[model samples]
Target: MSTWMVTGGAGYIGSHVVEAFRAQGIGVVVVDDLSSGHEAFVPADVPFVRTDVQDREAVAAALDEHRVQGVVHLAGFKYAGVSVTRPLHTYTQNVTGTVALLQAMADAGTTDIVFSSSAAVYGTPTVDLVTETTPTLPESPYGESKLVGEWLLRDQARALEGTSTPLRHTSLRYFNVVGSGHDHLYDTSPHNLFPLVLDALVQGRTPTVFGTDYPTPDGTCVRDYVHVADLATSHVAAARALEGGHDLAPVYNLGSGDGVSVRQIMSAVASVTGTPFTPQEAPRRPGDPARIVASGELAARDLDWQMRHTLEQMVESAWRARQAAEAATP
Candidate 1:
């Protein structure tokens, strides 16, 4: 069986990608620093290396040991708002981390990579629906770092154009990734909207909606939320496409093209959790886009991407998982 290395595989999205790969009968070796990932999230049977992606020697060793065919790079600092306050940290984790991982791949002669990028690359987009052709105007250090990560992949590939081990790469720019494909694996992100709302309700606290003065119809931030599982499916597809010698766009947006506002998400949380409480409004957060929705036409055409889960389903599953997590907590 061909094994692939998944950086941040113990993380919420990375864990789901691990599961998706396992479901497809693919072998996986997980490498995570556990800074934000949970060791329990990884399956006991799968191989795991507890280290940061910046540890090029350790990552290269793992790749060689496991005979990894490719890599799904998802390990990095992901908080857009927090990145504004900690630019250096963001660049170190996202940019320097990517550089180290790419270096490790070169060492191990692993040529294929699927980068887990964010929609933040197209910061506060001007178009109604973002596409692959959209201009990249990163507003935060996190966004800028992700863009630089993509550039690294392209530049590395270009440098190895005539080499024995030519790099094959793709970056999947995800919008708001939510929902629980499995109740056992829910999002635990403190900065993410879904987890924040769910955590508030779980603790009998009112969920606070940050920024109600955005330039959207609801006067709140609008985002294109995609189910985490659906998003994971495309990561695997991208990996397979590269391994199969199939050409793909350097970047693909895994967006819904359907805008959902914070108020709407609050409403969904209220309805799904059977807790009808108005969310407390707050000032607009730093580095938050007023609205961002993107067309997944490119990914759908190439990587079998589609919105399989509805908004209602997303909230319901997340609530279910949150409850499960609470019950399991000591």
Candidate 2:
């Protein structure tokens, strides 16, 4: 069996990607520093290396030792609002870490990779539906770092062109990824919407909506929310395509074409959790966009992308996993 290394395999999305790879009968090596990732998320059967991705020598050694054929890179500082205050930390983790990871891949002769990029690369796009061709003008340090990661992949591939082991890569620009692929692996980000609301509910507090006067249909900011499981499936597909020698676009947007309002999400959470409480509305935050959705046509064509779960299902899955995680916490 061919083995691949997952840089953030112990993280929420990265763990789900690891599960997807295992489901498909592929060998996986997990590497995570556990700064934001949980040590318990990695399976006992999979070989795991706990280290910072910026440690190129450590990562390269793991790859060489495991005979890794490819990599799925998802390790980074992911909070956008926090990134503003911690710009240096964000760049060091996302940008510099990616550079080191690429060097490690080169050292280990791992030619194929799937980069976990973000929709923030669009930086509040003016278009109704963002596509692969959308102009990238990142607004935050986190978004800028993700965009730089994609550029590194592209430039590295070009630099290795005609070489015996040229880099094969693609960046998956993900939108608001929510929900859970397994009962054991749930999103733990304190900054994300689902978790914030869920945590508030868990604490017997009402969840508050930051803004309620946006130009969206429901007067709330609209976003494209994709289920993490479905997103994970596409990562595996991307890895498969790269290794199969299929031509793919340099970047693909993993998103839902239809946008959902924050109010709608709150309603779904209420309905799914059977907790009826109106969300406290507040003034719009700075830089919040009215509507941000993307077209997944390109990903669908190449990566088998599709919206596999409904809004209610997304909320329900996330809530269940959150409860599971809470119960497991000692």
Candidate 3:
């Protein structure tokens, strides 16, 4: 069996990927520091190392010890606003950490990688539906760091690939990742839109909606929200594609193929929670695009990717998980 190393496997999306891989009876070793990830999310049977991905030596040791054949690089700081506040930290975590991971992979003779990229790379796209050929003009450090990471992977792949060894990689660009598991592992980030709304609804407080008068159909910002499970499926598919000797570290967008306005999401949340909560409108957030939808054509054709979850399903699952989490709290 091919052993795999999943960085940030204890994180929200990473944990889902870990579960999916285990369900398929694939060997997986997780490396996480629990900074943004939760240890409780990590599976008990899978081998885990509590270490940073930037620690090259530690990562190398983990790779060698786990006999890793490939890596699903999912470790990175993803908060867009926070990245604006701490650009250096974002670069260090997203870019520098990836550099260290690639070096460690090279050292361990692990050549395959599937990177967890984001839609933030297409900052303020001029086109409504973003494609693989869309220009990458990231507005914040978070997106910039991911773009830089992609460049680094491409460069390293070019430098290392030959007859003896080959470096193959795939970067999956995920849109807004919503939804939660049955186990109640909700998102820890207070910055995410879904969690923020859920938290406010749980507290009987009004959720804040930024920019109500955008150019979108609902007069609010629109985004392509992809279910977390769909995103996780793309990751595994990307890994399997690379393991099959696919060359070039191509980028693929993961979205629902349709855009949902903020108002639509708010309505869905209210319907799911059975609460008539109104949103407090505010000025637009910096670096936020008016409307951002993606064409999942590449993902569909290449990885056989199709989102099985809808926005309603995502909202309902999130509400269920949030209620479960709150009920469990002391």
Best by lDDT: 1
TM-score of each: 0.99, 0.97, 0.97
lDDT of 1 by residue, 223-254 (tens): 99999999999999999999999999999999
Q: Indicate the residue-level lDDT of 254 in model 2.
A: 97
The lDDT of each candidate is 0.95, 0.93, 0.86
Candidate 1: regions farther than 4 A off: none
The sequence of per-residue lDDT tens digits that candidate 2 reaches over residues 1-330 is 889899999999999999999999999999999999998999999999999999999999999999998999999999887888899999999999999999999998899999999888888888999999989988888899999999999999999999988999999998899999899999899888999999999999999998887777889989999999999999999999999999999999998999998999998999889899999987865445677799999999999999999998899899999999789879
lDDT of 2: 0.93
Residue 23, candidate 3: C-alpha displacement in angstroms: 1.3
For model 1, how big is the CA root-mean-square deviation?
0.6
* Ranking, TM-score, top scorer first: 1, 2, 3
Better of 1 and 2 by lDDT: 1
| Highest-scoring model, TM-score | 1
Cα distance off (Å), candidate 1, residue 294:
0.1
